[model samples]
Target chain A: MAFDIFHRHKLTISGTQAQALEMARLRLIWVGMLMMMGYLAIILRMGDLCLLHHKSTAMLMGSGAPAETERPLRASIVDRNGNILAVSLRMASVYADARMVHDPAKLAQELAALLPKQNEADLFKRLSSGKAFVWIQRFITPKQEYAINALGDPAIHFQEEQRRIYPDANLAAQVVGYTDVDSNGIAGIEKFFNKRLAAGGKPLRLTLDVRVQHIMRQDLAAAIKTFHALDGTGLVMDVNTGQIIAMVSLPDFDPNHIGEATNNEKFNRATLADYEMGSTFKTFSIAAGLNSGKVHLSSVFDASHPLHIDQFYIHDFDAKDRPLTIPEIYIYSSNIGTAKMAESLGPDYIRDFYQKLGFMQQAPIEVPERATPLYPSPWREVNTMTAAFGHGIAVSPLHLVRAASAIVNGGILLKPTLVMPDNPDVPPQGTRVISAATSEKMRRLLELVVASGTGAYAWVKGYDVGGKTGTADKNKNGRYENHANISSFLGVFPIWHPRYVVLALLDDPQGTKATHGFSTGGYTAAPVVGDVIARMGPMYGIKPRMYITRDSIEKSMKPYLKEYKEGQALASVSTDH
Target chain B: MRKSTLLWLILTVFCGIALFHTSQKVHDERARLAALNASIAHEKQSIRVLGAEWAYLNNPRRLEMLAKTYLHMAPLSAAQFIRIDDIPLRAAPAAAPAPQTEKIAVKKISPEIQPRKIVALERPVTMKTRKPAPPRIFKKRAAPDGGTATARNFRDVMKSLRLGVE
Candidate 1:
């Protein structure tokens, strides 16, 4: 009877419908859970393959191309003298896949607390957003990477990126501007040559000598601080070859931390700021009158008092009581005398001279980022007089160097340059804007200024140096501030041969008790040029010759000058009549 | 049946002769190949010996020492690195002279021939001096003969001393 009952229970047809429905539901739920696990496994394997492989397709990590996962290539930058100036090496940019992020709030808190720089809330917000990828930190330090790696978060990933490093910290900061977080050039020569860097080729070489650059930066920076000055800029150039060996601008930023820098720190004052160059402009004006055959070395112009114009007085810095010879005018830096000399030449000739010197044009270099010189629109009598003493016109230090090089480089004008291998040391394609004779007289007169006049303190013992001291009153609010002067010194070395030209300017240098409470070119910027010349003299093999005799300066002029007997007879009538 | 058996015997003999001739030809080719292999081995041994000699002669340290002592010169100074702009732009650098191929004359010493000997001899001079003061006592002489005969008067002397000396 029990066996028969069990057999009957196995065939209970009335309950089989509800029993079959329950069994099918259980099987369907199990199948759904298995499919979901399989999809999760496949997604994780794909992520592992992509993150581990630094291939081009793995560029989902972002920032230009895929991060260089293994032995990332570095780009090099070299100076003119074949020295390494800056380089970009392989470094890690740590990121995370928020979709793979486990305990997002906890990981973000850990990273934020560890990084010290980023806010925990912001990191938590970005991490919890369930993104495929997000940059937690870029250009992280090696020590920081080790600490983050120790946290051992499987979701966190690292993408190797190139980080720029300037070995010579502040030497050529303005010229070799820094790169961004993703290693893209943003300013200066670095920006100018970014395309060459992206290809991972050899480092782009510039025409800067890191040694000379260091000397300039050190000298200018010390002067900038000593005078309690706002800013400063300095540049040294080869007159014959038109190579910028050294250039520096103060209040410069560290290229490593470029993003945090202000505009003043990033400003390339040497090539960007155009200032009224004061008596430094005399170098060009004298070159004009002498080149136009309107004046000779013995030609006399009166600096007896202020030269009265239409409601304007062109006064001299060191006014002479009577008429002065051309040499005396330069020796004294007589604004009134130079103004008369400019008046005699006429505005058309002066403006043509400026145009020839490239002063009316943009900064002539390959950097592609430079300010054009501010010059008089039409050459007027007032423009001629004011421009004579560096009042009516303003120019960048690069233009000033270019114009000075033209006046002294045997009268052959050459534009300045920054690139090296491509230029191959070719001098600028410039015409003879001045006679060789005028250049020689200008060199002698310049030497006299350093030896006996305003630039007397800038004299180097053995280096036959010549220069002009310019202490121009800065025009702040349409009127000049007497106390706030832009002191600059335009100097050349071995004047008999004229090999190098230097210009150092200090902006708003205040008077100091250390400077006898006087902030002029001689006190503020002249010493910087002198210091650069002293340091670079031996480096360039420009030794103090045993004899830079007067005969040497007098010898080059012999080929083009006549005796002053004719000029002296005319000088009496020149002053009286 | 008799003709079939005779034909079978003749065919077997021809087949045996053919195998013998073919074996002789195969042996000849094997000997030639073995000789060629021996020649190849000889060439390989010669190359190994030459390679050993080259490794002996080419020591990097020695070459570096030689370069330091004689061949290398210091780099030119910036004063030496003149701007192309500074140069007159008229001429290029001078060319080096052509390397000479010197022919060294060898004096062959034949292995089958005897080497020429260099002979150096002292001249024999006999001076008859007056017996300076007769010795108070005459010393006994072992032999008065100062000729080649006396020189060869050891335990085994040659009878024809003149011929031996010559």
Candidate 2:
């Protein structure tokens, strides 16, 4: 039985070995089949590539017919009224790979002659440096490219590039800005609207008017030259829409040759330059009091002596005494009275009010270049006194605008913007700081400044002009400069209806003989506002005002005084901090 | 069995299908590329048109005329406008119109002089030439020859338009 079992086991083992051999044979057959299939596939693909197609993909790529790129042509930029500000023009940029060049001297001579800017010897020396590649020229003119192409050297290359051409050399330079060699925005609205410029389907339209820009630049340039100003800035904004129509900065750059401009020439002063904007801050002070129900158009404060505090005195160019009315104080721009009113409103309320007015924060705009207004980290009493007269707290011309805009644009606080906001369907939301009644009264007072007070020279007969003049001594270290002054004027025109905000500022302006050795805001800046208004008003179809009636203003003031008097009698005695 | 012939047949069919697909891919890519190029070309053409318009519009003489004609805005004066303030207010007309008499003048005409009268009217040659220009010399002869025929043809056409030609 054991011998029989052993024979069966041997048979079973042989069967298993045979099965394994069969499996190996099948595996070999499968491998052969796979190899045959793969060989067939490879042969077919190769024939299809080398024979059937007649051209390889690599070869096709080397040839220019179907290059794997479909770059969109760049878009043009226009103004609000469809004036073309900046537009992308097609051109060629030339470069050369030294590694590919056979004759360095020959290539250099040809390139140098084609581009007269470089010497042939210098070009040859650069090519002989054994570098892999060298840039011959960027943003070459079409004629230069043609002259280059006539050389017909194998090593020479031309890359298609976009060149932004500015039609108006210096008009709206700060507004349109200039593009870099690679067509990237470097400053102004171009820098702000970089992504939109790149996305190429739709043109970016600004609120700038080229004609208006020319008139302004022409006027402003004359002003800068006349005043012996180190720098100057001017802006016109649509108070209704917050559209910056035209913004000009002195020492302006040429967009066509923007790369050649210095850092100072490129700075946008109207929007980015910051300074102690003097008594212009007073507009906010009175607005705060009116909003707080503690003051009225008839409110009085003695302006004869400077409002004296611990080591600080706030007084105007000419002092008044015996309790002048609010309109008279503003018309005269009495810094002493303004400081007292700011005290009446107190620090907390003023700080909060400035905060709501887009001050004490980074200015809002699409452009990356924006300066934050310098406010006291700890709001104090002395800070309040200086801030009231616009000394301690430094702000940009834009801040002065944001504050003054509210006073002119009814009692509502509208955040100023660029880019003529997308929603034409909806007007921008603004917070009401003072009642319409107070706003009406303020308009009358501001107009009275142009008509009868410090800004008297700014009065143009036909226009219902209203504006405030601001003159501050520049701070060298901490204290204000007695000689070097920043003179600025903020104005709202057709002041009865108020549609536009025009601001003019001159930095370190020297007094001229015509100005009677005066560089104050009224003398230096107010006249510019008046000229801009007279020039722009008729064009905008704002018919000239035949008369400056004081009826509506007086009516608004009577009601304002009675309400404020009752509130003052019953209000909290101590709201100051 | 003729295995090589069968293999050749399958390979031929496979090669044909692959070629069709590759051809289709190339054609589709070409169509896409053409469309993209066309679009780029169209954009470039449009920009050229806009630039031409801008150049024409921004001509200095044109702008000066516009400033004068529109808005009573004149060349900036030293007396009316001092050099102290030049902040630009861009609410003004950017490029003034052609200042056509039509553009600036109101249409309220006084009925006193009955406007300028038309002196004379040019008479057309009536199948006869008093004075025929060189280009129309042949036309004068042709017109005389074809006048009766044209009048009859027009009568027939009018009949045809009335649906009676058939």
Candidate 3:
């Protein structure tokens, strides 16, 4: 059989037939080989599917859920107590495919009815413009979206967009700030932490307490109305941590309606606008004097007459007309006494002291709307005298509050912060601006002011309130206007162990009948500070020491106050400047 | 050889059927998982909206207004607070002996006290069983609106409720 297979076979057929038969045999062999190759390919593919491609196939089939929804475009902003101040919500922005819209006039009418703010004529123009897409309304309410959807038009559609919402409205308008339509932070802390907020994780908690903010705003607003002031600002700060608990700027605009706000309403007076802070600066000058050992509480300064320095004459608003002890000088708000005290300390020492207290530069706070303090350059002798009386220099209310906090909070000058720290239990450290002994003496002297001096109106029974009142004539075009003045008060309560520092300022306050035509700080702003402390004392759970009496405060300050009379007919109304 | 070929053919058919069934089941599960994910996303969005609304509703200014209108309450005054030590202690009760015994018994049963050790294993165990105490009876009192017969009137009930009787 093997020999026969090797032998060639002969065929009895014509040449063409034999050739055709040979071709047919070759084609059949080719077809059979091709079929074997196809089977082999199928086996290889089956093996690949069962082993090499298993993971890919399983992933494709099993992971059918859509990729995780995108994270919120912006994070929320909360108060110190975790109350929502600002949030970002996914909202429906309705638009139209103008090319597909039919009866532009009719559709415009329907949309105008649905959206009261959208004008019918404008909608018709947008619809008839033949543009492929046009926005009908942005950030519509859910009810409006529902109503529009009921129209059931194929041309109309909605695109989900992120919108920033300020839930507290005008309560914390200047601090929480507001965002633009594109969810971009525009002002206040919103503008300051734009990048961190855009990253979108946990909420950005601020140091503000909304309840305190409400109280401050309500009280400040009432004071503004009562005194007929043009504008006002208020601030509250933690003495140790420098956390701003409440900040209010009057004539503030609602963040929810940013477009309707005027430029004046948008101005953050507390942190941005600088003013000649009048008598509030006395707290700093007295602290500097006491800290430098240049002037003790018992030291006497001649406030009997105006003192001449260069072309300017420094005079007390209500002249004491006698050599005044340091405590009596502070309580009387004597400008001449303060100027003489600064003169004794010299200009260099005063400038360096002010620099250490952070008065020479912009206030160090979290908000971006901070103002650089305006002070005389070259530190002239006259500038030192005027500055000691809170003139020839200007600073924001925030700066005053921060400095006052340092003076009352054991001499630690902490940088004010609007954002709460991750661990609020640990207080941020501060630089020492004065000796603790000096701060204690300053506390006693301040309490004495409220006890029997010009700031007598600021006294709140049992709260041991201590403060200084200032009434500064506003400078306009380099000239001081007498009638137009800034009245302010700096208050610290439970003065023995201070916890909070509050400052209230009124711009161009007019005197009312109750004030007897005197719009000085003692008559106008001191009462406001008193009211704020009276209410805040209870809200903060600070137990009032009924044992603390005016007599006790005066007795403790007796060594510093020479010939201080008891129940001295509450110092004349316009006694402080 | 024919038997083995037949056996392999049957096995391949069974494997094919099983693979198809599993893939089909996986597809159904993926669809359900997708649906759940969608609903979860929706619920999260709604919760954010509700949070915003809650903040707006709880705004201090609004709360103050509501409180002024509906609640007869004023802000806490400084006079309301007093030191804890200022509160005088209550006078001694007339029936103090019974409470004294109970206090001693509580001390005896305290976890801090260790049980006495047995000196000898041969001692017989004595189990003392006390008599069960009788259950106290609670008597139903008349409704604040005089009686249930007259309490059917809704206005009267509302008036009584407003007066804080119920």
Candidate 4:
């Protein structure tokens, strides 16, 4: 009907009426176009919000409210088996805009009441300082944050920060280290791998097995308490891979409160403290002798009496007062015999041997705390003799462990590492330090030490345990103190197929009733190693032999044993106990 | 001309309805998507908190203390472990038929003695009178030793339960 009316009007309309109708039609068309454009814009905006620009918008939202969704700036540090040792948890830190405070003194007093550690006066000074922004406190607990948030202070604001938390507390404190409030690593592996960890991809997988670490720490702590030692250190490493399964230092500080720790607590004895690891170094000397082809298992060194070299007299700890075969020298830990062997090899060979064992330089580990070996200058004859018996030269326990690994693990001196290698099964192809035959003989000698000699306490019942003991007098003011001794034991288990090297040391250990008043390595450190092996062996999948015995070790060392003359009287001196 | 106008009107109406429905569907889906994204963010936050809590709970020191206090279980030692093949085989039972019931307490023989409580409570059910199917997912398994896997009775199940409790 409208079309019929329009048709009739069109037929009867004059030019003026037609022009008015045309203007009205054009206005309606323009209005319709404008409405369409508005709908199209709405559609485009919906598309953008849903698809094209959604991520950018979400990012904007996330940045504005980062406390809830922000990822950690630093990745977590986990053990080899994916157990978390250190993690960066998102935490709200309390900060203050001092310029925005209404009444600085009043706000400061109120905040001081909330934070018990802060005095009102100090807080007032901080708040009234001319600085526009100041940090009131950092890494506050959620409860404290809530308490402060409840204050409704306009001047105080919370900033989201990543707080490094060591969930295991002091378990691997010296290895994992601690980060500063600003999330900068200052010590240990955290400092060493700061760049990669801060790059933030996957969790940093360390080679440490926290279970084994706990075992070592427990035994070392117990030994420290029992012997009344000043401090103790323990380490366990895989012989083939050089992966540190466990590293422990007693008097350790909780990484969460790294700032509160004293210098003594922060001292990493395992890696940083260089000690004259007395008789344990004899293994290296004898191995060097064997490797240089100057000595064999039957090589004899007359250790009947002390040898006077200039003003210094090199005396055997357990003087046999008779000729001892090379293996006997190792098993008995005859210092004079080892020094004699070193004298024959000369300073050049001895120094070369030490260098080959990676003992002449700083420890090649992933931790920042490392000690450079106190290598004797000029390689003089006296220095050579003392270094042979492990007196004149000093190296960290980690250095000894790496060299020990070379002696028993097929003569390959692998670089000790804290991070688990990508391929752990393939052993590192390290520098050849000794012949395979020499390494085998070294294993036999070490086993013999645990079997019938000073390391008898380190003998685990089921495992093929083998190691040497070192009881060194503490050097004080350039003189060796008789009473103060660092007793240490370096042990390897399943010696036939060497796997783990465990080293335990007690600093200034005192003898106890349990130890029969003997503070030597054989008495103090060896038993701790035995306890660790007994507990950690089963966990490492080492089966205990119930029926099999190691009588063969005795048979192999028979050539190294000598018969005493009837006229020669032997005095029983138990120096190592 | 009239047909074309009608056709145009139909096309315009159809197009208008299609666009309106499409927009409505898009709006509904966008709302759903936003809700899902919000929930995912919430869950991620929860997961992060839970991970931290898990790490704290699994701390070796705390676990060791707990084990020392409550469990009293020392770390597994080498001596305590044995290989599976080390275990010896058991001896065969004597070739004799077992008695159906054994008396726990002996009494004087009397004709007037009442039946024991255990013996009086049990009754045998024939296969025909028993329920056809058991609630458990049991298959008609042929025993490896060439015996039929017969369906156990309710009495047997109850006896097993009692044994479990004991």
Question: Which candidate gets the maximum TM-score versus the true structure?
Answer: 3
Candidate lDDT values, in order: 0.71, 0.70, 0.84, 0.80
lDDT of 4 by residue, A93-196 (tens): 88888888879888887888888877899888888886778889887778889999999998899988888888788999988988898888899989999988
Over the stretch A502-549, how does candidate 1's per-residue lDDT look in tens digits? 889999988778667778887678888987886677567765643443
Q: How would you encode candidate 4's per-residue C-alpha lDDT over B75-150 as one tens digit per residue?
A: 6655555555444332222245344222312222222333332222122222332232222222354433344424
User: Which run of 10 residues does model 2 chain A get worst, by summed lDDT?
Assistant: A568-577
Candidate achieving higher lDDT, 3 or 4: 3
The residue-by-residue lDDT of candidate 1 on B1-166, one tens digit each, is 6999999999999999998998788667666756776677557535533433333233223333322333323222212222233333212222443333111111222223312321211212222331222212322223213432333233323343223231
lDDT of 2 by residue, A254-331 (tens): 788876888888888877777888877777777777778887777788777766788876666665455666775676
* Superposed Cα deviation of residue A338, candidate 3 (Å): 0.9
Q: Per-prediction DockQ, in order?
A: 0.01, 0.04, 0.43, 0.23
Q: lDDT tens digits, residues B72-92, model 2?
A: 224332223212222222122
Task: Name the weakest run of 10 consecutive residues (lDDT summed) in model 3 chain A.
Answer: A2-11
C-alpha displacement of A458 in model 1, angstroms?
1.4
The candidate maximizing lDDT is: 3
DockQ of 4: 0.23
Candidate No. with top DockQ: 3
Give candidate 1 misplaced runs (Cα > 4 Å): A1-74, A109-121, A141-152, A423-428, A546-577, B1-166
The CAPRI-style docking tier of model 1 reads: incorrect
Q: Fraction of the real A/B interface contacts present in each candidate?
A: 0.00, 0.02, 0.73, 0.48
What stretches of model 4 exceed 4 Å from their correct place?
Answer: A1-72, A143-147, A548-552, A563-573, B1-42, B83-86, B94-166
Native contact fraction of candidate 4? 0.48
- Model 3: docking quality category: acceptable
